[model samples]
Target: MKEKLSFKKGHRGRTVFLICDVIFLVLLMVCMLIPLMKVLVDSVDPSTYGLRLIPKKVDLAAYKYILSKSSLYQPLWVSVYSTVLATVIGLLLTTLAGYVVIQKEMPGHKLIVGSIMFTMMFSGGMIPTYLTIKQLGLMNRVITCVLPVSLSAYNIILMKSFFEGIPGTLYEAAELDGATPMSIFARIVLPLSKPALASIGLFIAVGMWNNYMNFILYITDADKKNFQVKVRELILSDGLSGTNIGISEDMLKNAMVIIVVMPFLIIYPFLQKYFVKGVTVGAVKG
Candidate 1:
């Protein structure tokens, strides 16, 4: 009778927690939806309508204009190229570093992990970072945007924690089978840690896609600038001057925002399952 009552209470508590979670999710969705809907409406409507919650009319003129303009295409490509390169490089390096740090017998492992973690809590200021980039001959180059901030200390820690959670007996078994560390990592660890890798990869991809400060500070060439930097320049130059530029400022702003965000929207949905699973596993283990 006591066990039955305990089980019933536990079940009831879970039900209540689930209900609360659903309510919170619904409210969060509504909050996010409002701004997204506003941007969509503004992108399609004529800007002269002015601060409208609902669009007066729907049209694709803003998108059409932006695409047709040659000036926008190069920056868009630059941003895409930079983001892809950075994400790939970041994922590889972070995974390797994480794996190394999780090895209990690895020499200087603690010191290495400590140094990496220390960087997470602190960083050199922008001026110093820029100077270092200049000293390294990365300034005014496309590689500069991708290389400087490729591997984040936080992502490495998360990945290391995920790796550490794997049973040590598995590694011992692999060794008994004459498996080297590389083989064990590739065959056993990599397959088991897909969720964690996917989550970290998505995080790195988003950071790369949204990055603008690096481009602004390191890239001086207008043609070398990424989409975000280009959009800012366009907004400042035309919006502040009150020059029509054959398109309404608001429409341009809305269109640029949509362009920047649309890729994330498309990619994130497909990766949502992996991201959730990986994050949950990592959290539980860490």
Candidate 2:
């Protein structure tokens, strides 16, 4: 009778714990859902109902207005070009660095790893970074956006950790087969590290796509403006400031927001599986 009572108590405790977990999860999801739902509603709404939860009317005029304007296309192209270039370059450099540092016998590996990790914890502030960029003669050019911040320490560390998780026997086998380091990286490591690579690439790509500070500071030419900076100018432009800009202020603002967010929304779903797996693998290994 005592044993049966104990089993019943255990079952009841588990049921209570599961009920609490469900409640917590529901609340967390709702917190995330509310903001997303609000954005969708606002994006479709004709009128900006200030601070209201719901819109009185729905319309796609804002999207239409933004898409119809030819002026937005150049900045969009610039953003795309810079983002793609940066993502590719950054991924390659970071992966190479990570792969090198993962070698246990590499000379000064500890010092290199320490320095890289130190940079993650410390940074030369914006003024110094801007000054360095100016010295490099990257100012007022599209390359300024892609070249200045090509390699990130956090990404290198994550990639290194992922690489470290691979079995040492694989490296030994490759060595026995007369595989060069580059060959091993290209053929074996890369294939196995897809989740990590995809995650880091997406991260870098998103950062590049959303970058405004680099473009604003380095590229003074209005013609070289990225989407975010261009959007900012459009948002702050009062009707009296420019009669020929064509698009209305409210419509432009909404449209720019949509444009900024749309790419991430579209791409994230496709990479959702890899993203989750990469994050899990990195975190577990770390």
Candidate 3:
């Protein structure tokens, strides 16, 4: 009923290809690992100067400068505050909006969805957005970071795609059991949407956490300067000369970059399975 598979001469060629591929991948891994190792070494170097793979001396003044500064804590708190709010609000609103658009029976479903899709490709421009924020008195406020970017058309579409992949019979069954739309969404749909929620929530959290430009624009208060902004000024203006004698500018900068990035680097591995599953399912199902 089925022919036996044979490579014959092609087997040798396939083996050669595999060997080349592995070599190339190992080289690529080495290239990436080298730079990261250099950063780690330099950040702890007592007197950093150039690209160093080995530390001349191990000192943690770079990390200490940040941790000891009371003012720096404010920025860390701001990032956390904005990220948490945006993720929660974005997920709830996007999930509701995504669920509504998938109901073919709803009036103007096509129109509403089309309008949303339109905004993704076009925007009112930067000046208009800035002015709008200013007019709303959101200017110079910590919450400005959360409100302006709390909803993204792309995230909504992602949720919509994930929701559409769910079997329609589930909804019908829930309706027969006298579940309202809100109840069905809260209990049934959300329970099945963990993959999507994890993926999208991670995206929002990372974006908000790394949002440097938003703070530069909206938060002007001296006490409200975020972690990135503070580090940027330190590097640009010269090291905290009076306070940090032994620590180098490059060392502090590298340490700050690592601090911001390490959380996500640690987190992404845990969510990688769900993130890949969600995106793949949405792509195929949509």
Candidate 4:
């Protein structure tokens, strides 16, 4: 009759462990959610000095004031253009470089792979990189946003690992059918690589969207500045007191944070399912 119970002595330990893990996860989620809720509430609340879980009153004045500004549009366009362009270009380059690097028959392959990995561990300092950019005449241009960050070692490695897991017989079949390397890559490899592409594309897009340092350092033209720059300016300009935007500093800051973060929140849901699968493929591929 005692054996009828599923809760054996050893099973009790695992059950307790699971319960503790669930409690910890719940606490962690609450911690994260509280701050996000506070930000959302404060951004729309007229009085933003204090943190309140539930806002006493609703106000859209902060949103109206920020959105009504004319200068905001140019930076928004720049950000969108640069982010989309950079993500596309970077993804293509990463995929191609990764494919080439993974090919065992390619000559000097080890040296090329080593060089790529070497850059991952180290890089030329900012000053030298800036000097190189200057020499290349990339300053204050849209290309400056895309070119400098187009190739990432980590992304390339992840793509290579993912590609390595594809069976070689497929490629051999393609070659027997008179398919060139480019044709095989375009038709066979790319068609099977949605998860990897989505994962890498999302990473590049987020990086470009959040990039602030590059714009500040290299872009002197106001027309070339992106959304992040405008956000920074609004945050740092005495909390925008000089602009007389009619919104409180705290509220404006919160509003800007929400505005900047909104795109990623919108985007992540579409990629959420593929992200885990992509990362697992890249990480665990033999």
Stretches of candidate 2 exceeding 4 Å from the true structure: 1-19, 47-57, 239-252
Steric clash pairs (candidate 1): none
Model 1: how far is 16 from its true place, Å?
2.8
Better of 2 and 4 by TM-score: 4
Between prediction 1 and prediction 3, the one with superior lDDT is: 1
Stretches of candidate 4 exceeding 4 Å from the true structure: 1-20, 242-246
The C-alpha lDDT values of all candidates are 0.84, 0.82, 0.82, 0.87
Over 4 Å off, model 3: 1-34, 47-57, 239-244
Clashing pairs in 4: none
Model 1: residues with Cα > 4 Å off, grouped in runs: 1-11, 47-56, 239-247
> Which 10 residues in a row give candidate 4 its minimum summed lDDT?
238-247
- lDDT of prediction 4: 0.87
Report lDDT (Cα) of residue 50, candidate 2.
Answer: 62
What is the alpha-carbon lDDT of model 3 when measured against the actual structure?
0.82
lDDT of 4 by residue, 1-286 (tens): 5774555856988999999999999999999999999998998876656768788888777777777778889999999999999999998899999889988889999999999999999999899989999998888887887776767999999999999989999999999999999999999999898899999899999999999889998999998999999889867875444236566777777877888889999999999888888899988973
Compute each candidate's TM-score over C-alphas.
Answer: 0.90, 0.88, 0.86, 0.91
Predicted structure with the largest lDDT when compared to the true one: 4
- In TM-score terms, candidate 2 sits at 0.88
Please give the ranking of all candidate structures by TM-score, highest first, separated by commas: 4, 1, 2, 3
Model 3 weakest lDDT span, ten residues long: 1-10
Q: How many clashes does each candidate structure show, in the order listed? A: 0, 0, 0, 0
